[model samples]
Target: MLSHIDPNNQPTMVDISEKSDSQRQAVAQTLIQLPLALKPYLQGEELILKKGPVIQTAIIAGTMAVKKTSDLIPFCHQIPIESCKFVIEIDSTLKVMITCEVKTSYKTGVEMEALCGASVAALTIYDMCKAVSPQITISQTKLLTKTGGKTNFKRVPQPLYGLVLTGGKSKRMQQDKALLKYYDQPHAKHIFDLLSNYCEYVYLSARREQWCNTELASLPTLVDHDDDLGPLGGILTALETHPEACWLIMACDLAYVNAGTIEKLLENYHDEVVATCYQNPEHGFPEPLCALYTPQALKQFQRAKTAKIYCPVKVLQMSNCYFITPGLAQEIANINTPDEYHQVRHEHH
Candidate 1:
């Protein structure tokens, strides 16, 4: 229904030139809690499913939808996405989660892209599983969270650090964030150094690609690789790779993370604490960029990284983790494009 944005009066993309310049991104996912009858048909032997590989095809379709979200929705702005990634995962009981992340350098937000990716993936599941049973339920198609651009918005994700994913085609960046250097230091190195003091033996997880070389070469680094789940793949691999250790995770894109902020979290950490971040007054939730995780807290989330329930926070919410209180907000600001880098540099200096 026409709830947030007006429809009949006519839909038009809003101009956001007056909008403040800040890192903006959007995350959305759909939950397809399929019935038990459709379980066997959802997953078949081999990466290839009975009709089609559900995760792979859904990802491809989701990415394509992300690129054309403006065309699909009249009010959606046609912004050039810096990166787009989709992940599909299923739990032990066969509940699926599909999550999509859309990043860009633009005047407006990318909620449309995230929603489009989730919606298209859900539709793809419908197309793939119709043969087995028409009983699939594709509800919860909405923007889970969004930040950057005019409004640095967010929704409260769960406190558990079920996954810390870092995957993108990087065709545009011409380099992966993991290997990219800032101040003669690797990007992941920046976060690693920032988080290491907070979490013991912070795991360095990544796909074993040529670009992932430098990041992986470090000794004692945990390898988290699952190509099918995209970025979520990295998170699953992290949990699986270091099943025994407590994990505090962050993305490589965020270059200005403050160690003191994270250290404060470590100072106040409790056994029940799951995630920690500098809370946003506008968003009202712990930011995902800087989060802590425990093993027993979310083992099922790692197992279900390749099905419909692909969002880590969804599993984290269900699993339950405590958020570190007031003092630790604004610690994470992701640097996506040239403009953003310059902006952050200006802000810091």
Candidate 2:
């Protein structure tokens, strides 16, 4: 029976008063194709057109559409939206994908809200980019997934990998931090072994000069594709190499990170957020080096790269990231210099 049609064949709204209230969520996605000629103008975070910053404007438009979904769609129930999030990405093929996730605590689903949000976001991109090139085409508007209410569902979790960053310049340390022995083994080898416990596959992120170490020759290594960008380049290389996998990244300089610290991070993982990071107790910011980054976060990193913002910490600061402080604050410490290394070594021993 059609809920929108009555026995008298008249259009009517479904009565949801009897339905029990429960948390509900939905996700929708759409893509916009830009002509190859216009791709050059689409810079990092903002494409400053005559209208405004393209990506930022699309985000606002998408959020507004989520709130006004009921007004636009006649049959959709007005939902009290608890939250709405957007993830936008521009791939190598010049296809821009916009995903909208909507959440509510109500009797009905928020699928329409998600769809509306994604549609509006795509339209906003088209509007902003039209001045640059009229060849922009929006397509693939559809619901990606939904949850809560009577039925609950989700897409498969992306594959996950462990990435040990071993490319730091180590100017202050005056030696390769990764090669320094902490537990009678090279720091890089120690971290790799730790990550192996939780991750299905592990790889080392290194620079050209660091890749030829005879001790590290047997292990899988990813040379930084953009060598000048430091840790940011390592992360980008990992994401670019395996776009479908979530990366659990650990820096070589983190001498105190152990199994318990990794366990705590994994236990407190937040899938909805782009990344789950440790909050630096000293600096009061998310520690970028030790974190679990989902595929959504990788896309944001791509956007940051386009905008010439090479700092991963800055990207995490701006995006929706879940941060937690370690029980032992010292566990997250980075041994950047010989003094710091000696101090940590003494403490551990």
Candidate 3:
């Protein structure tokens, strides 16, 4: 795709004079699967290295790569990067995945910048550890996602309250459960703040038209259903916005919520895609709207949304949902009508 621009032929940077000045961001990731023997080197606790610390060198090298992107890629336009942040996360199998997110306020996007940064960073890892083991394999070198470059794009969809649908919203709950309040903040805002504890960038998923950002009118508010179909609709939106990350879908009406509860959910979260389990006297295994979801449930939710079975419990019961049963039921109390809202509000919200 980048083979078009000829900087030498033009002798000057091509003018994106007609392009819109929308904010642009790019996310690139590279997976480095290393042997368990080398995992200790990356633990960062006591990086006692005769050569030097491993991660510190990688960060410095990655930053340099960001500046040299245009020179490395001939057709790529040189962008003055405003900010670049790199994160390294390790999977249970000792595989280190590095993500580079670059942001810029300019005429063009910084995808090349982010890609170069991540690639160089991964290569640095290989260069540092090749003497110990030659079995390092780097794969999945594609953009995790990018938005705002002449067009809006997302690798996945998202939800409104914490970007995942944990359950269905009954009409009796005049207020969209997500709108309920706790800690002097709305329910959705509470969860939004909590998820920020784990994720680098947490976004609220809702129809762009339904909500307004008083602070930043231009901040992207994701739209679902192209219309509103309730909680499942928001869930689909979240899946659209961030398809790769694990989403915690806590019902807003859940009164006894806290960040600690979210940490417990994340602590018990299995890679097999999981949700919280609540045993109801009436409904067996009442799949609580308080669950964590992954892209594994996207297609099922899409099909259900089409068939009017937008309830998340049904999806959990019928599909392969890893249930997190910590016997934490009190935190799952859902608020329905005004009376219930007040009742829960007064009793320790």
- List ranges where model 3 is wrong by over 4 Å: 1-23, 43-50, 157-289, 295-342, 345-349
Tens digit of lDDT per residue, candidate 1, span 261-280? Answer: 55555544434334444454
| Tens digit per residue, CA lDDT, model 3, 20-70 | 666889988777787766766665432224557656667679889998999
Worst 10 residues of 2 by lDDT: 151-160
97: Cα error in model 3, Å? 2.7
Q: Residue 195 of model 2: what lDDT?
A: 92
**Pairing residues by index, what is the TM-score of model 2?**
0.56
TM per prediction: 0.46, 0.56, 0.49
Q: lDDT of model 2 at residue 231?
A: 91
Say what the RMSD of model 2 is: 9.4
Candidates' RMSD to native: 17.6, 9.4, 12.5
Candidate 1: worst-modelled 10 consecutive residues by lDDT? 156-165
Candidate order by TM-score, decreasing, is 2, 3, 1
- What is the model-wide C-alpha lDDT for candidate 3? 0.65
Can you write out model 2's per-residue Cα lDDT over 1-349, one digit (the tens) per residue?
7989999999988899999889889998888888777667668745666787788899999999999998998978888999999998775556787889999889999999999999999999888888778898888787767898777655433576999999888999998889888788888999999999888899999988575746777789999999899899999999899988888899988888899888776755545568888998988988989998888887888899999999888999888776888988878888888988888788778
Cα-based lDDT at residue 234, candidate 3: 70
